[model samples]
Target: MNQSTNPSEASLHAIDYWQVVKNRYGVILLTFLLVFMTALVITYVMPKKYESTAVVQVRQKGTGIQVIPGMADASRYQESSSAMFFPTEFAVIKAQKTLDAAIENLDLVNRWNTDLETVRRTLKGIVDAQDIRGTSLIEIKVRYNDPKDAQKIAKEVAEAYRERRKKLQGDYSNQALDELRKAVIAQEDAVEDKRKLLSQIIRTEGIIYWGDPSVSGGPRGFTKADDAESAAKAYVDLEQEKIQLESQIETLLRYDGPQLMNYASGLSLPDNIIPVLLPQYQEQKRQYEAMKSQGRGERHPMMLSQASNLQSMEKDLVEAVANLRETLKAKLSLAQEQLARLKTRMDVKEDDAVKQGIANQNFVDAKNDFETAQRLLEQLKVKEISETMQTKITEDPIILHEEPMISNVPVSPNVTLNLALGAVVGMIFGIGVAFFLEYLDTSVKSLEDVERYLQVPVLAVIPKDVGVLYKQSGMSPDAEAYRILRTNIEFNRKNPEDNAITVVSGGAGEGKSTTLVNLAYICAQGGYTTLMIDADLRRPRLHTFFDINNSVGLTNYLTTELMLEDVILQTPVDNLYFMPSGILPADAAGILNSRRMSELIQDVKQRFDLVLVDSPPILGVSDASVLASEVDLTMIVVQHRKLPRNMLMRVKQAVENVGGHVIGVVLNNVDVRSDSQYQYYTSYYTYYAPAESQPMPSPVSSQPSQSPQPRAASKKTTSADDSKQDLY
Candidate 1:
């Protein structure tokens, strides 16, 4: 029956984050409210800002075609660098000159009543330009205190940038014309020199070209370089024709006209015999055979003449095809000879051709320069003429793609967004604080907390304000917790007869005495004949509960040769008795640890169905350990969230160290009203009515003049004389 519970064997409880949050919810709520209120106040004081935006298309110049009414149309839609243009455009829109132009055009300096530098700085500060990514459009936005001003500034800035671009392009055009005019004069001088060289070459080298017969000698784009090129082309054509003729003749010479014409234009060649012979010979021979069938003599003239016609016809067809093929061969050989002579002549003129190519190249360069100059001269003259009448205007590369749009609503002090952000931040910070406080707190708060730390089952959860259970007229909800403690003690004790249980705590005012008396009363009501000994000799309260004089009880009985019946008295409750600490003995531990005290505990265990000894906090005195060693079971009574877990373990260790059996624990003074989670401890509240009446003969010493002194007591038997005489 002496079962030992080892602390090492118990599993440590994991600290639940949510449990900590629930326990310290009030602190979290307060922190959250403070943060949220601060954010709200800041939002309330923020100023409103109006914003307007204008969109402009920053196109690569000349990508968009232009329509001019008359004259030759210029090449438009030319491809250029577009991918790299957007970032440059963004910079240009915020340039100092561009912003200055916008300010002057809008008369913003006077309107703002500011100096030019101040106006420019302010405009730049308010302006923001962003190019739409992967696109050529730029958004020019302006923020201001006034909506009208925002809109006006946005529109004026876009127009100013457009005018600036047009002026740049016009200036570039004039500079380009001047450069071209210089090029034309230089080219004219070079062209005259080249013409004189060409005349000298004709006179000195007699380099005149006789036009080629096979070449189509019309004027190509480079007509000046075409003379020798035409002749070379004609000779190439003759050589190609000669090769074709030779291949055709070779195929025809192997063919007989009577055989399959393999090379006869669309026909193919066959065996080296006449194909024409087979049909003519077969026809004549069939005629000869038919005439022989008429019984004509062997020397018949018709048969002989038919045979001869076959032979003659075969010979003529063969000769005709062969003769035609021979004629083509002769013509091909003659053309080949002519091509050979033409190639020889061309090779002899290689020096002349190289010289001619140089002169022609020079002429072409001079001509191209002169032509380009003439075109530019005409365009510049036309531009000058147009400018004299009215300055020519060209389209701007960056134009206003969208009109400026001004919003009616202000964009600042967004209440919903601010509130949402505030809420999220507040919750996170509150949770952090909650966990921090939970970490700092070391009190045991729940059954799990106590069991995990102390490695003992919680016998009961004695709710807060336990006075209501005793004073109320009807059955009270709080009485159920004491009953549960009694039931758990009966069930958990390895030996049911181990009824001498001491209820001890780590510190004074942890409700150890109160819990012991209540549990005894409940047990007595359950027909257990419970006895409560206020071995808390340091501060006797059990007899005070019965209004029995506490000056004569356990101390007197243990310290003197007194009878146990003299100190023990029946309580007002039917089967309950009270034993008070008679007096404070100076040698309290010595008296309590004496063999007489053990005899007394053993005697009461036999007499009462249950004996609950209320001892001083074990940590505060050695007397509680002496009492615990004498009892059958040691039960620690702890105040909820009051005593640190380490102190509770110390209490348990103190009893077990003295060779006492610890049944479990009783978690007393739980605040069930504030935390509904503890309500489960007395879940049968609906079934329990308030106590109809206080137990009969309630204690006369109910009200205390002052709190009892420190739980350690040491005096003598003189203090407990009144209750000792009842034995006589």
Candidate 2:
């Protein structure tokens, strides 16, 4: 026996999800239709609307006027210009004053028939403004129930904005011009005073007086010639000092060489010695030459003494000359000093000329400034006259183009979207319901469920409303299923010697007795000697179904002193017999478990080809289990959708616990037509239905093929000699 690895997968085989869809297809179609119709109705009932838009450009403008001191400078003017345009524009766009004016001009409150509060709200709704990104543009749009009304409102908003802008510009420009005029006048007066002071300084300083010199030239107060003479004398003195320093340096260089020559000649020094001693002799010679120029000699008595002095001096000079150098450093120093003095004197004259030139330029600048101020004042006066003459649109306001418009096709009543969504939602709900029903269903509906839950092979499926025992009686097509079950049982049992079968179920109404009777009928019709025993003593039903006498049945045989032949009765069907529960036994379990009962079952097994015992529901009493213990194979009959799974399992367990081998399960009363998956087998009955006019199988054999054996020939036959014995 191969077992499934996953019991859940095995269980799923019983519940076909697609079959659920097929069975409940009407529900799904109705759901989709309802949702689609609802969407269409909602879409048809919605309202429509219209929209209109207007466009406006925001431009920046600057007035040639100043509001603060030095505001005319390009940097300050640029900043002020930006400030003027932005603030005024924002005020025109957002100010309640401007909005109210626009409302009044357009007669919006009257048109809307609104109060002050409503008028404000209406204006706000109709108008909107925002600076276009990275540009100076604005868009105004409005929505209304009527397209003409939307266009009218949009145009009115634009006109109101233009009027307000003109007024704001005029007021701001006039204010700026007035302030600028006063500042320019004040600046002009200050510039004139600065020029006068500069002219006075030029005259008093007695500088070169390059322009208009006669203003101070009449004075002997200061003369250019006198100053020039002083500067010349100072220059000459510095030159003379420079010349004397140069002459002393030149005289030292010229005489020093000749004295060194005299010293070298007088000593008769070697050429190498002369060169080495020459420098030292030159120093002494330089001093001697100075003294000789003042009338001293090398060989006078004074010269003789001087010669000795010279020798000593030469020795000292040699030491001094080793450290001395004729560098001419002092001459360079004196010449640099003289040159510095000359440059300083020249710089002084240049300074005076530069100062006079700076003063002249200052005077000219002041004159020009005064003239420019006069010209600006004239221009402002002209502008003021022009502005005063012109009319200003004093109530302009900014307008925006974009507005919130309700769509004619409402965004909410979207038919296609809603229907699609409804379909998905409904499918989810339907599948949930299907699975939920599957979870609650406890009956054995399919072979897979019976096998998985009961752990038994499905012996047969009895089609629902089978008319086998009624219409054609034994010749009905429904009898075929039972015949198949009989064949399966014979094939499944390993030993032909152990052929006593007991049929049982979980509950009373599961058709166990009916199954036994019909199975016996089919076996007998197939030429096998078959007997059905009504072992359900609690409620005996087999005799009533077969229209046989049940007063002298199994209970009578067990309790009375009677022969087995007296209790058993031959049925109307051929080769078939019924032994009903004679009378309800007080202790059916005890009676069924008696040694006599075992003997009876053994006798029937040998005498008959097949003996099917119909026992009571196993769960309701101990009678079924007691009979199960004595039978060769115990088969359970489960009515589809009648017994719960746990109860069915309990019935199987009861039989097994009593040492009975459960051969298989029979699924009874299955609705084959409605459940399509089962229809393949049951459909044959409908397609090739047997005619109601067919004859029933004969109760007795048509012809005897073998000799009828006496009781002595059977291995376990009961004696039938006492024919008058009381069975009940």
Candidate 3:
């Protein structure tokens, strides 16, 4: 037999996983059932809980207060400060002091079946506050075993928070009011002092006010009279200058009429005519006008036309005006010079007066602005002093109906779930048990199992209850299975010359002898002339089946002086013979090992077409091994559920040790009906009719029927001659 190879990692993993599934299926099922039951129990037994909640709105405080520099806007400061204070509120609610107070107020210790410490712990578990999204609101939730208790606790906590808020806000408001009052008073005093200083400065400066003395009034300035006086004086002076210039120009034109006419005549001349004749004169005149506008002399022009024109015009006008004023020559010169001097003096005086008036007006306006600012400051101070701080809760933390106190219905323990889990577990367990039994079983139940485990061909499978072969001397279902064994042997024998086979078993009572007898019968039926030897001297059973005398069988022939023919007996079956065990031998192994036994087997093998030696179980004694070493082929018989696989291997080893080759394994005493795999092979023989059912003829005197020789005293004989008639 070939050695089994180790399975690959994947194959081993699969096998191991399958084994675990098989072995632990029951445990898994039980665990599932327990888990389901526990869930169900817990669902039925656990307490239900209810929840309650309150909504509290937080509002900024001291928003109305107005403070000095370095103090932020009251509303902004309060909002920012609230963040720092909120955690304090949360800590306060969680504190033992607050919890104890709540307990005392509600008398929760007695009402809730708890001491102060336990009540505190329960309160800690139940109460929580969280800020509302996008708003200054907090949601307070409480959970309790009782619905009413949950609601009551939530409402009470809300009420406590409201009271605390009101107290805090009231205290803050009082403090702010005191500080505001003192600030207002001090500001009022400062405003009064500033007002007095402003009034004194106005009085010392002698400024007059025209408009209302309030900041909202239109522009007011000190002394409008002085500005009006100076503006009127300047208007008078400009009017005088205009009249003087007009009169002087008119006088010049009238008095110097002839000379002016001569100058105008000279100017009237066409530039084309005058350019060559009076070029210098025109140039002097043009230069004189241009230079006069630019405050320069008339001789500046390159042609000198302006200077020459001005000199000629001046001489002519002077002469004409001198003639007109010959009688008052000195008066004319004096009058013109006096007019020029007066004009200069008037321009200087007007400029000085305008400058002085602007300065005075500007001073008065500055004084008025300063006075208005002082007045507004006084008004603000008065208002601040009169005003009082007012604080109010913008949005009160209201108990919008307390949380709904409804208990939950736990649905964990489900009977259906448990049953389902249990079924799955049970199936797993059943498969595990099946595989475990398969692993532990060592007996050969099928040809495949035998071939796979032992790496040997199964010669045959002998159906169970083969004892029927002894009762009905010929073929039976049990006998048919062995005939199949014989056929397989005949076909599988490597050498046609090797016809002597030994039948051995791993243990006793595995149907080895029956197999040998039946196989011999089958061989004989096939016209092979078969002989069966009961070589098990230790416990001979062949004589009993053949109804032959064991007194002078194989052991007697092999060990003593008995002839081999004396031990060979013919059975009722035609062409089938048996050699019984002879009387039990003390040294069965020793006798079987002798040279005579070998000679006997050799002799029989030569006489019969097939010789089957029925030896003792190989595992039981050395008899089978001895026979195996002498025979051409050794066949091992293993009963279903008889010996373990290792023990059978030991049997094979024993045979091999004796130089015997085990041709095949014969799985014996198999229950074909129970094990349906073998039913096909065992079923046909069950319904088959024996060959004896055919017609038989009476025996006639074929050789003058010789007188029957006295039958051997210890041997029983049954006739196979069908034509013989018995006469007793």
Best by the TM-score measure:
1
lDDT of 3 at 316: 52
Highest lDDT against the true fold, candidate: 1
Which wins on TM-score, candidate 2 or candidate 3? 2
Candidates in order, TM-scores: namely 0.59, 0.51, 0.45
Ranking by TM-score: 1, 2, 3
Ranked candidates (lDDT, high to low) = 1, 2, 3
Model 1's lDDT to the true fold?
0.71
Off by over 4 Å in 2: 1-15, 20-340, 343-424, 440-449, 452-455, 473-477, 549-551, 585-587, 590-596, 671-728
Write model 3 residue lDDT over 1-728, tens digit each, in one string.
12344456667667556544543455556655665565566655656567777777665553434443333444546554655656666665566665666677788988878678888888898888776666666777777777678777877776666666667667765676577667667666766666566566556555455545456454355334445455556556656655654554455456444454443334322222322323444556665566688766535564365455566755654454444334234444555666666666666666665665665556556555656666666655543443332343243433344443443532234456655665665565556555666667666556776777777788777777766354574445556666667767866788866889998888777878877777776565544556778888888888888677788788788778977667877777655677788888788889888899888877876666678888887877888888999999998888876788788778888988999988898888776655655677667776763565554222221211112321221211323231112110
Q: List model 2 lDDT by residue over 538-592, tens digit each.
A: 8888888767668877989898887777777777665676677898878889999
Count of clashes, each model:
26, 13, 17
Question: CA shift at 342, candidate 2, in angstroms?
Answer: 2.3
**Model 3 clash tally, residue pairs:** 17
